[model samples]
Target: MFCYQCEQTTRGTACTTQGACGKTPDTAALQDLLVHAAQGISQYAHRLGKMGIRRNAADAFTLDALFTTVTNVNFDPDRLEGLLRNAAALRDTLRADYAQACAAAGQAPEALSGPATWEPAPDLAGLVAQGQAVGIDTRIAALGADLAGLQELVVYGLKGAAAYACHARLLGREDESVYAFVQEALTALAEDEPSVDALLSLSLRTGAMSVTVLALLDGANTGAYGHPVPTPVLMGHVRGKAILVSGHDLKDLEELLKQTEGTGINVYTHGEMLPAHGYPELKKYAHLVGHYGGAWQRQRSEFDAFPGAILMTTNCIQQPAPGYADRIFTSGLVAWPGVTHIADHDYAPVIQAALAADGFTDESPVRHHLAGFHHDAVLGVADKVIEAVKGGAIRHFTLIGGCDGAEGARSYYTDMAVALPQDTVVLTLGCGKFRVIDQDLGTVAGLPRLLDMGQCNDSYSAVKVALALSEAFGVGVNDLPLSLVISWYEQKAVAVLLALLHLGVKNIRLGPKLPAFVTPAVLKVLVEHYNIMPIGTVEDDLKAMGLAA
Candidate 1:
């Protein structure tokens, strides 16, 4: 039951009894079993691919299994156990196929050990018992913290990359290279006592692969939804039956909007989906209404107060409270006990639930929030931005993006955003922008000071914008007057950070705290190689970035 994969780990250490995100010991144990089983499946799949035999289904399953184990994504122990059983079955099937292929080729098949040869228990008790041998702590005890931490870093980064790959696959986008790297990385992690240097190299390779998947996701999104255009979204209530769709799955939301069209149901974006309103294709829906709430961590209170059904399309789902549990529905790898799960992209159940529930009784005052300032939109104004910079009207550019959580130190982002100099523009993405989305940072050089990129995956947009500026200014990205102050809560953010380092971006300030799984030795390596630093006080960070002193 040991888990420490998120920013909010209990007391900055492992959660041995229960996760701070409300995952039970039983669920945690089941998640560990699922990951181990997936690694076993990857072992066989990787070998099979080498033989020029591809199994897309197995690759997709590996991604789904790993994504489900992400922090706060799945808490249904029954569902996790079901996945574990499925993964074991898949591994056995692949192993036999690989053996047959080798025999037919007149080559002796290799003997498998570790998770590949181990058998799973038929029941929950046995599964928990099986997890004891495969847990990260066992590896830490045998290999020491530095090596264990490096291995976990690669594993976590792979999980995040898998999540993005899954999203792209749903949109009918598949990259065989990404799938191959995913299998290769997982199989590498399952090896017995790899050297620290090898693990570190694999970690960076995982980061490099993450950039590919993110770019794939970005293409999937913009190709399907059209390049994001700056659009003003109403932040007020609309009168009608309503359904709130949260998480980061734009495809799911698009389908729901299509199905709910002309129905009395009004669909509102919540959490990371708030930025979906900026997409031209998705925004074409008349009933797509405005955003409803703040970040994912505040959903307990926010969902209860909303007088309609809610749909969670991805991770960051907390344990549902009893009051709204029945009306909440989950899809796309998010599951909670007693919550209705809409499978196969079906939203009829969600639509019915919205119609049956009490929606907003009355309309509220109107407000607006700006989003969709994606790469194209920002780059369209590159001339003006460059002029401002050269004329000394814009002193600096800071990117305050990444995951937002319930941690108390998260308030530092809001403070930093508000305290930046009037001439500096703040670029934001991810749910982290929820902290300062409503703040009026005013306009600088005729552009709004706060520019909202897309979701966390849209870190691609930020990267693109930075590269464009660098090219325009005839300097490297790190030499530009830009600072990256990122806040990470889960593995996707880890993948994004790895991508940043892979791009040779340095001196970035990351907080509210560094990952618990990153041993001091690993942190030392990062500091020495990349000059990455932990976030200091808001004022201190501002001064350090040359924003203010």
Candidate 2:
């Protein structure tokens, strides 16, 4: 199974035999089949939309199907097989509708291209098709590994958006258009003879939807939990039975907090969920402990160190190590066969796992780090930030954040931090901070030069900070003295980029090598329309940013 749709892809190339993320050949093939089936459903929806079906129904179908295939989200073969069957059934329903529409229109029903046309395959065609799709196929007859890779990149970006959208949905916030466009775009990806321009347009559309999805999640988070405030979360160990919740799903965290409310299980946010502490609603839970791990890549070490149960709510999952393998509990779209997966967002098994794991025998130990840095908290310091800029205490704000990977070229970020002028402040979030964070970058006046804004999802904080700065200075964000030098590795980064574009924040510098999935035409539109440029050497990129080398 050749899969290279993530930063952790083997050897900075494709995952040709087995996945670096612990995905087996069978699982990878299933994921490919799942995507293929979803595409069939997408085609069905497109035909139905042309025949006058309300766009919302079509989108919901596509969103759930696509979200299920995101890396590390669903590894249950049984669940995936069920979804594949469901997608095929939906496609058939869509096909029947198409036939009826054609009959009513007095036209012959054209044969749609997809699984609907598949026959018995004599060999392992899934990986071959994925490879050829990414490497060779120019048209839909096959997807070359690269374009297939690019399509997967776009699809993964949409998966992150859909996850965010689902969270927002629980909070009573809805944007029908985001749903509609996601469906239409997924459908477009399956079409024959898709142009580079069209795929590029779809990437931007994905970005646009990302903007809407983020806004919806922001509203849902702030509306339900109040805007995030500057609250210090204890990274120290607590005495009692404990449960560590990872990933970025707030709703799951909320439910766990409720279930373990009166129970002895102490709650802690790991990885991306660390920022949830700033939100008033979630922070109200006194038992909500501090973060347990660093980034997703460090899970094997971190999870093993903790003695309690670890609950995974979303992506960034690694192949579990034996140290914490039995103690790990997954929820929502995250699944691992044989591991106890809590469906319907239930918390009983998670609670049971926490109990069975024999959490801390003592009351608590020492605190480690602090988190909860988010938009509202940063905005609370808006006046001071403006004053600092006006008083020349702050010269410029640089957002240097994105996903992290094992590629040695990624060290460029560390180089960037070392080279950034003392007068500039580096704003960071996500695993990218591993490149340069926790180092002495000095300060801009009295303010620390590097600000840890949180995780990849906390790119929301960077966006909020940019918007607030623009409002205070009475200038557009792009005109402000801020530069976004981002490094990406996965789909979450894709959503963040889309959000940046939706905000019209231009001239952003992105690197360590633009996604191999983006065709040349799509790159052109991004470069021309958004003025997006790839990052160069620290020396050259700094010179371009008007920073002294």
Please give each candidate's TM-score.
0.98, 0.86
lDDT (Cα, tens digit) per residue for candidate 2, span 264-302: 789988877877888778988989977665667788898
lDDT of 1: 0.89
lDDT tens readout by residue for model 1, 1-549: 778888899888788888999998888888888888888898899999999988977889999998998987899978887888888888889989999999999999888777787687978889888876688888889888888888889989988998998899999988998888888888888865588789888988998999999899999999999999999988868888999999999999999999999998899999899889989999999999899989999999999988899999999898888888889999989998888888998888888889998898898888899999999899998999999999999989999989999888899999999999999899999999998898999998888999999799789999999999999999999999999999999999989999988999999999999999998888999999999899999988877777774
Kindly provide the TM-score of model 1 when superposed on the true structure, using C-alpha atoms.
0.98
In the predicted model 1, the residue pairs found to clash are none
The lDDT leader among the candidates is 1
| Model 1 deviation from native, Cα RMSD in Å | 1.1
**Candidate 2, superposed: residue stretches over 4 Å from native:** 50-52, 55-58, 97-111, 115-153, 361-370, 407-422, 433-454, 471-476, 502-504, 519-540
Worst 10 residues of 2 by lDDT: 131-140
Where is model 1 more than 4 Å wrong at Cα?
none
lDDT score of residue 507 within candidate 2: 95
Error of 2 at 244 (Å): 0.7
**Where's the lowest-lDDT run of ten residues in candidate 1?**
540-549
